[model samples]
Target chain A: MATGAEQAHGAAAPGMPQLDFTTFPNQIFWLVVTLVVIYLVLTRLAIPRIATVLAERRGTVANDLATAEELKLKAQEAEATYEKALADARAEAQKIVAEARAEINRDLDAANARAEAEIAARLAESETRIAAIRDTATENVRAVARETAVEVARAILPAAASDPAALVSAVDRRMEMEGGA
Target chain B: MAVEDGGGLSIKPMDQFIVKPLFRDIEPGSCMPPEIVEGCLKWYEPSNVTLWMGLGIVATLLLLVVGTRGRAIIPSRSQSMAELTYGFVHQMVEDVAGKDALKFFPYIMTLFMFILFANVLGLIPMSFTTTSHIAVTATMAIAVFVTVTAIGFVKNGAGFLKLFWVDAAPLALRPVLAVIELISYFVRPVSHSVRLAGAIMAGHAVMKVFAGFAAIALVAPLALGGMVAIYGLELLVAFIQAYVFTILTCVYLRDALHPSH
Candidate 1:
């Protein structure tokens, strides 16, 4: 078997070194060209796309946070408005209740005043009727007493010597005695 | 046996090793001549695999840019994959270094992908292992160190220098701490580059040695069996090395962005 060193000397063909240069040169050149091309593709194309994607993702996250904040603010505003409305409703309800209570009280007071006036007028009318009745009774009693005195005088005197003055004096004395007894 | 067919002893292929040169045209000391180490800023030879790895880096950048040209709500597949990778790196940066340090994600991700692809490509048959070379790895490490240092200065100006002297030391121990910090800062690139290159080179060397053993001991089934086991282990080591390289880069970037930690 031929050793590598012996084969090197034995295979001293012409243009071998030059051919080595050309062959290796083409291979290395193409390899380098390919590498450069790949690098360019990566840097100019792939890397930028990747960066853009990342930037977009960041933007999305920020936008989402901003939207969340806005929504939270809106919710808070709604809560505040709801609370205000509730308070207004409560205040209005209280005002209505107060007015209703006052109106009822006023109506009750008017009714009470009318009842008192009616009672006072009835009492006055009853007092006036009682006085009239007393006056009539006194008059009837005086008329009856006078009539009885005249009847007694006529019974005691004779027909021929009938004098009105003498008979009245006698009857008055008798009536006085009877009244005293 | 003493009949003379030639003046000198006839040479065979096996005898060449024991004899002087049969071919006089070949220059002495010309075989396997040492190649000159290239300068860092030279226009990289397109034939060199390191240049190809660098091209791969550029390709990754281009793919990202073109994929993300028109952003949509629902992404195309290329766009989605790109986004996923970006998001993954972004999250990692944020998680490792905190949100304040996320600004360095682009640079870190670039470094990670470039190293990753270079490491992976080296695993292919006949492909050049760019990260395996000290010069290439060191260059990358130095670039990272410079960029991070620049970023720190840009962000904090003179205060950035305080990262080495002020933050880690008590007032009484400031001078001693400054010396130690300076040493460590200087050692950063060396450690970073060596770590990557060493792992890759060691792994490749082991794989080659085992493969050679397997070829030479073809008749010995036990040697073949051992080689099989070594090959499997090498595959795992390859992935692990790549991962370690990427993670270390991330850690270094984290340190740069947040020196307080």
Candidate 2:
């Protein structure tokens, strides 16, 4: 292609090299070569590397997300296990409490039974002792009454005085009749 | 090239757009032409366009090739940028043009890198705007047009022509819409190339105008401020234009792959 000045004196247009067809071949030729060079650079070198980086980034992202999801699931499983273990522990604690309460109630019942038996035995012994004392007092009052009756009789009428045995027999006979009635 | 209409104080905006041979006024003892200049392929003569274009390639390769040499799981800054560009273009092609069009993703990326770097590199002082020239951008646009058209024909057979036919419209309007659609379809390359070139050219021209105005001592500050503002706007335009060009290519590829209407 001829230079802008090299073109025949007045053949080329006065303005706009773009409109000047004489040099179009040269410009177009370089444009094509440049385009081809750039195209080759992009397709063969630049774009592929960029694509690889992009794909790697995507792969990294996907791998990270998958790992995160797996970790989340593991965390959830661990949480469930923790909850279940806590529930088991709680249930075991309740069972232990119920068993302890039952044991305490049994021990309390045994202690109460033992104490009641001892009190009942003590009351029976005391009742027996009281009966014995009453018997002794009844005998003493009879004896005293017999002795006084005899003395009074003797004082009142010496001639009409009776024996201690006869007086006691009479009192005993009257007490027996009243008791029967 | 631009001409000073009034005097030397005035600036010529079009001079930056001129193309020249890389070797100029070379004396025998001064310098020798590079191997590429004297290579067997006489067809491949390096010009200013080729020089800037080569720089654009080196820049692209620096970011994509050398920058990503580490390939660190955690990318370096340049590697990250390269990856971002790759993903952005990859996704655009896959999403807009469908999975089948992913095969052509490299081509889309090439166009994007070339245009994007060309525009951005052009912003530097004394750097040429390769994309601003229809010579460069038109070539890319025509290449996309041809590739997609071929894909359409090969994949969809003669049904590829259905892209121009409007079956949804009423029978009377269908033909009219088809005619309009056909004209628009054929002009894709022209508009595609013109849009990028025009945007870049206009921005540079406006900056030059401001730069020229700044030459006047009275309004130097205002002209400098305006140039700064426009330059900032142009920086944004540089990236946006590249994005627009690439995405439009994807859209056109989509139509070719699935030319239903």
By lDDT, the best candidate is 2
Please report, in order, the local distance difference test score of every candidate based on alpha carbons. 0.60, 0.83
Put down candidate 2 lDDT per residue, A115-144, tens digits, no spaces: 999999999999999999998987887778
The candidate that achieves the highest DockQ relative to the unseen native structure: 2
Could you give candidate 1's per-residue lDDT for residues B1-261 as a string of tens digits? 011123321112121111112222333223331353221112333435544465556556544655656576667786676677677677777777667777666556766666666666666655566666565566667777887788777777777777677655578898888888889887888998888877776665555544444434343476567657766675676556655655666666666666663
Per-candidate TM-scores read 0.50, 0.79
Model 1 DockQ reads: 0.07
Q: What tens digits encode model 2's per-residue C-alpha lDDT throughout B1-261?
A: 223334444355765776666775322122123422322122366877898889999999999999899988888999999998888889999999999999888888888999999999999977788898887888788888998899999999999988888778888888889889988998999999999999999999888888888777788899999989999999999999999999999999999999995
Which stretches in model 2 have alpha-carbon errors above 4 Å?
A: A1-25, A129-181, B1-9, B22-45, B215-221
> What lDDT does model 2 reach?
0.83
| Candidate 2 docking band | acceptable
Q: In model 2, how large is the Cα lDDT of residue A125?
A: 100
